[model samples]
Target: MPPQRATLLQVAQRAGVSRSTASFVLTGRHKDMRISEDARQRVLRAAQELDYRPNLMARSLRTKVTKTVALVSDTIASEAYAGRVIQGSLAAAVAHGHLLFIGETEGDPVVEEKLISDFLDRQVDGFLYASMFTRNIRLPKLLHGQKVVLLNCLTRGAHPAVVPDELTAGLDAARTLLDAGHRAGIYLVGHTRDQVFASRERLAGIKEGLGDAGVRLAGTIDCNWWPDSAYDAVCRALDDGLTPQALICLNDRVALGAYQALREAGLRIPDDVSVISFDDSDLAAWLRPQLTSIALPHYELGWRAIETLLGQPGEPAVQRLPMPVRRRASIGRPPAE
Candidate 1:
């Protein structure tokens, strides 16, 4: 037979006090209830001896606050690159004495709706809608009038959000190259469009950074975010004798293609040609001469989302976290003529 659980009645009897007095002491309401300190200590000791555990569900029913939040995301739960977002959210939720329930929708509206409905039914205190990438999102109707925070994504409405400052990241990347003394032969390896927020902001930042240095971009290649397209673009540039002193790639994948093209042209990294880029993925460090890049701050984004939903101080309606540079072997002083 299984061992029976200890009850508050048993604890109160063992402590030589009424059940109400024992309850007041256990719940830290002894002072409000005017219970003596010695009585409170006796109740605590009795609870310890009896190994008593409170019924959280009953407590929550009386308090009317479940102390739980739901994290709803599209692809973030499965994607390795965005896993830190979940880790950060979990840490922040636990720190606040709350529990976090995670759900992935895989970009399906039906799935998202069902998940939101289920969470609402469970009496979750708040919702965190996250995304694997930075883009505009359509929040579900179920989240209306409820505490909700967007993570790594934004909406047209006044919902609070936490995302990376792509513009600043671009500017920083350009400054990193310029700081290495590359002036006239700096080339951008990707182009930006209207729909993609990061690309547009990052490109603007790069232009601003270069303008600050009193210099201009020598050239740009439209690679459409594909490594093969970047490789082809770099090959064509080399064939046309466009030997740039430095290359600012769109992402680590684009940089990989540039690396291959550079090797084919017999150019050594940071010696004959320097390289820098963004999205400091594992591939950045995996390259032969490690690629210097900017991190997306995925974990901080998630942490800030929870903080915003929890009504924590210093959380803005729209929070843009800084993207720090990861220094590596791919960047150095440009070769002298």
Candidate 2:
């Protein structure tokens, strides 16, 4: 047999006070209820002795607030690199004394609709819609008139969103190379055109940074975010005698391929050419000459998304988290002619 859990009535009986007095003290509304300090202390001491905990579900019924939120995502929960978003959201939710429910749609509208309907039935306080990547999204019609914060994504209409500062990331990558004295032979690897939001913003930032330093891009090879494509591109470029002083890869995967190609050409990292990239994935540090890169700031994006949904002040209408540089062994001053 199991022992019964202590209740407010037991606490009140132990403290020689009414149940209402015990409730007021436990809820931090003793002063409002005209509860005396000595009586409040007695109730608190009694609660401690009895190990009494308030029933949150009963409290929710009285307050009409569920104290829970739902995180609806299009693959954020599944992708390894983007999983930090959920970690951030969960931390923030727990800190604020709220519960979080995560649901993955995998781009399936029917699944998303079911999740939304179920969350609504459970009376969640708000919704957090997130994406695995940065892009413009169209929210479900059912989400209108509901409190929602978009994460790692934006929409055509005005709604709160938290995304990475890709522009700054790009600018920082270029500035790092330029500041290291690499000038004339800087090449942008992968992401040929601006089809993706990150690619476009990062490229723009790179251009802006290079233009400010009075240098032009030596060339661009569109590898489309594939390691094999990047390997082929780098090999072809080197084979054609196009040796860049530095390479700014689009992501760590591209940089990995670039590393292989450079090794095959007998070019040592930072000895013959410097390398910088973005999306500071785990592979960055794993490389022999660790790659210097910009982080995606996925955790911060998810954390801020919850804060925005909870009506925290000073949150921007469209928050852009900074993509800080993770410097490693792959970057150095350009080699001498």
Candidate 3:
């Protein structure tokens, strides 16, 4: 037979206190009750000595609310960005004495729906949906009554959301390049006319920063957010006699690929063609000369998402958070002509 578990009554007996007093101390209610320090110590000592542990399930059932909240993400295993979001959310939840239930959907809405449905059946107290990439997302109707938070994306209606402020990112990047004495030939490598929220806002900030110095866009290229795609676009532009002294890639991966392409074309980073990009991914710092990139406030976004869910979800409004640019070895003054 298994050993018998210690009970609160046993702790009270050992501490020479009433069951109510023991309950107050063990449940951390002694502070509110103004219990004497000595008495509180006695209760704590007794609890530790007897190894008394309360049944969380019973406590939750009595309160009629599960202390668990579900965090749904598009793809958590992709890299540290998603993992960092989960880490931040869990840290906040744990501090609040709540349990976290994580769900990964791999960018599939069907998987997300199933996870939400299953969590609902289990009486989760709230929900958090973190998008892999920022975009407008339509939430499930079943989440109408439950507290929900959006991380990295926003809904159509008023909902609690936390996302990276791409406008700030752009400004930071431009400032970094300007500080390096780069006044002209700053090319922005980005998506086509269907600019996403991040891309559009970042571009606007970059332009605004350049405009402060009466500088204009040197050039622009529409490339898929992939290295090879950006490489091809840059190559074509170079062939067409577009002389870009600096390349601002939309992402680190694209910047890295552009580096390779430039090398093949007898160009060198910072020596011939400088480079910078958004998203300070691991690959950014690992490049040959290292890549200067924007730092998104990913952890803060995750923390805020969980905090908002703990409160009440309200009208969907966009909340812009500030981001900074990380200067690395990839950016420098234009080649001396």
Number of the top TM-score candidate: 2
lDDT score at residue 49, model 3, on the 0-100 scale: 89
Q: What TM-score, to 2 decimals, does candidate 2 have? A: 0.95
**Candidate 1 residue-wise lDDT, 184-203, digit = tens:** 89999976786898888899
lDDT for model 3 comes to: 0.83
After aligning candidate 1 to the native by TM-score, how far in Å is the CA of 239 from where it should be? 2.2
Q: How close is candidate 3 to the true structure, as a TM-score?
A: 0.90
Residue 189 Cα positional deviation in candidate 2, in Å, after optimal superposition: 0.9
Cα-based lDDT for every prediction: 0.90, 0.90, 0.83
Per-residue accuracy of model 2 over 38-143 as CA lDDT, tens digit each: 9999999999998898898888888879899999998889899888888999999998889999999999999999999999988899999988879989999989
lDDT by residue (291-333, candidate 3, tens digit) is 8888777777777787777855553466777777777888777
Per-candidate TM-score against the hidden true structure: 0.94, 0.95, 0.90
**Model 2 lowest lDDT segment of ten:** 308-317
Q: CA RMSD for every model? A: 1.8, 1.6, 2.6
Task: For model 2, state the Cα shift of residue 182 in Å.
Answer: 1.2
The order by descending TM-score is 2, 1, 3
